[model samples]
Target: MNQPESSKSLFLGGAAKATAASREKYVPRMGEESALEEVLVEDVAPVRISAFVGLLVAISSFTAAVAKPMLVLPVLAIALCLFALRKHDGRTKPVGTLAARIGLVLACLFGSTGFFVHHLKSRTLGNQAVYFARQYLELAARGEESLAIELQKTKPNRQVATMQLNEAYSQDESAMEQLENFRSGAYVDVKKAGLDTEWELDRRPRVFQKYGREKVDTYWRDPSGKFNGVIQVELEWSPAYEGEEADWHVSLFQVERELIVAPSVL
Candidate 1:
């Protein structure tokens, strides 16, 4: 008896896709020679190396949040992904095409976030330190030694001000040494010159982390004023949770005592 046409296809038996060569494939009739030889053949496109590498670099773009120099990571990753996408030939499904696109997305996400944060934090933090340094000097100029010393301290350190500041300054040699550094040298000159001394930034503020704490240094120089020196105002970042910013406070007030006397000034 002849089999019905409904039961003829090789894959699904009925209405299933089958090649004309799908005669008696794996289960052939008594004397069938032609079988499903080409039924299981598959075509795969070559995977692009650059696309995969772009994905990796994109993942590393997260480091961009740590510093400005790391901004290049995401930029490079985006370039690679774009190049790989442009290389697509349309006809074939490029193996790494999806990976490249995903990489591009990740790079953009991390890179932009980091860029915004770096600039925002740097500017605000630097300005804060500069202002704090100026106020500290102003207090010193007014002979408020206790207040100046207090401003130079971290909040917690300043809170332990139970005893008289004069006695405390003499006792906490370590803290006193730092406070003394601020009270003398450039501090004295700036105070003698009055509070009108303009604060000139020596260079771009430097940001780094030490002892697991974020630190920023704002270097101030006033060569045109009686101070004629560079002083570094250091601020430390303290962590705050629940979407609040990390609080920053004075950690150190250091004056660069190196002297520079220009003939033009004299």
Candidate 2:
């Protein structure tokens, strides 16, 4: 009886040891699996060329916003996709790794610069346009139909040259001559109404402001129209403020003008 009892006890002890070992192994395996499941998708994701993409997205959106109402949705979609790409794990890759990084950086730099540049220009043009429009409206209100007609003929639009000639005349005849010789690009500095010192602009038109009114440069090119039509004008303007000294010179307000066409017409 004693021998049988000893054997039973030994067998039971061995089974208990085996069960403990199995439990230990199983616990670690389960824990490892749970840990893997919790790992984030972004943490181990690959790199992508997203900075340039973001810039392009922004540019496209801006252009669409300027050009047509229908372009907004597509532009917005592109922008959203770019935002996602930027947030993705792949962004770092395109910016940091491989020869493609150079192109990506260039694209980012130029694209960003281009977007802001266009925006500034548009805003400038819009403000000028608004100012002109107000003047025209006031004339019309006073029953100065002739002047209003002239304003309409000269106001800026997709055909900016016409607006240039329309707005070219200054009280000073010398100024008019100066304008007729102007050769700058269309650009404007837009700022908060009171903060004229701060330059801001847009690359498109505005109903309340101006659109193609921002001049950068002027050159004559024949439009598809009547042959030998002398009704041509050229214009140029830019937002480049002429500043000198680290902090001594006051902001120069240059409204220079020029006519590339020998016979500029309204």
Candidate 3:
């Protein structure tokens, strides 16, 4: 009976050893799982930051399409997203990568749109200048000297007014004489040539070296599409004063008359 009891005790001890070996074998895998969880947590932080920045860039870019002052915001957001993408090379989160790409595309699209709007505004201004020039010539042709002079004096900045008055009286004395000629019908030949006819722009207007001034070139064509001559109109722009809207006025008007100097007989 004593021998049998000792053998039973030895078998129980061996079973306990086997259980300990199994637990030891699994310890490394548990450690590897814990390490993987820590890596995943670390990668998520940058993705959250990038997503937030991308949202801001999209909103600002839309606003800048109408509001000119908000143009700088998209530029800043794009820079920050690029930095985040570079910092975490192999472990870059998907959210972060997507955000960065969207931000870059929006910035480019809005920036180009802003430039096109500006160009259209400039062209509209040029067309307006040409219209005013034609009006001035028509007024003078009707012998409305006072009205023509009043048209020339249309709203101008205080500084521009002083400079123009000085130039009109002191430097370009012939300016008044030229207007007198127009009032006296010296340009009747030109009037017959359709000088008072509506003209279309020949090309894009040019801004001169002088500030607040633009030069517009226009042409009048016959019904048969025959090129008549070119007209050059100069305009000066003035900022709106208190209780007044901004205005543009004609400063000079000249016509490059198309001459038919017959070829000299050879």
Candidate 4:
């Protein structure tokens, strides 16, 4: 009545296969907990903060490029960064988290630089214009009638020319008041104009004569007595790119109307 050995062995083998199948179908509770921990580590990685900072810097740079009175933007940006850091309790986040801080600094630098450049351009343009005007008077003094006449023919709004010329006189007088010997001139002459006055050459005497979509001004001293000019100046500030540099130009002229024509041009 005892079971055959082969049959017993078969029964044991069947039990073992059933046990393996059950284990495969079941998941360990501890393993599930470990998987969740791994997911959390990935989700809270510092890379998230860095990516955000990169985006902030890009936006800041773009705004800085267009905002007028730009000096204020950088200040505001800096203030915002400090506020954020304070809210975070001064904790050091990822490197990208400091993008705003760096952006603020760069904004300030670029804004200041642009302002100074414009300021210098304005000042130099005004002074040079005055110099050419005064030089016209000097040319008149030396009987260089043709050159002086040519100036009037090469500028915009004769009235503007006269004003700039007077401005030069005022500048010289102001320098005199300061006990400084200053020699300068301003000139205005129509280079090219149309019914609507498409172009002009003002604030000249420090420019050159050239052909383009830009305004140019220059002051030249007629050497070899051919013109008896005092200062040979050429200036072209405005540019013409995609019609953006419409404020740029090239102008050339001679300056000689100086009661105290300094030994040289500064």
lDDT of each: 0.73, 0.37, 0.57, 0.44
Best by TM-score: 1
Q: Candidate 1: TM-score?
A: 0.61
Winning model by lDDT: 1
Candidate 2: deviation at residue 30, Å?
Answer: 46
**Candidate 4 ranges with C-alpha deviation above 4 Å:** 1-86, 89-96, 139-146, 155-266
Which structure is stronger by lDDT: 1 or 4?
A: 1
* Deviation of model 2 at 110, angstroms: 0.9
lDDT of 3 by residue, 1-266 (tens): 35687788898888989987665533332244365321333333344576558656755776666655566766666676675456554354555667777777777677667656656766786677667666755654555454444454556423343345435534556656755654454234235544445445666566443543344444333332433555555676665779788786666555655668988998
lDDT of 2 by residue, 21-120 (tens): 6654343322443653333333344644444454444444434435434254344444444544443333133331332334344435444555566577
lDDT of 2 at 127: 55
1-266, model 1: which lDDT tens digit per residue? 87666665443644343544354233333335664333321223667888999999999999999977899999999999998887544455778889999999999999999999998987776677667666665666677666666765555556455667777667777767866666675557656767676667888778777876778887877756666667777777777867755566777766765668767853
Each prediction's number of clashing residue pairs: 0, 49, 0, 57
List runs of model 3 lying over 4 Å from the truth.
Answer: 1-99, 154-201, 204-229, 256-266
* lDDT over C-alpha atoms for residue 253 of model 2: 20
TM-score-based ranking? 1, 3, 4, 2
Question: Candidates' TM-scores?
Answer: 0.61, 0.28, 0.45, 0.32
Error of 2 at 253 (Å): 30
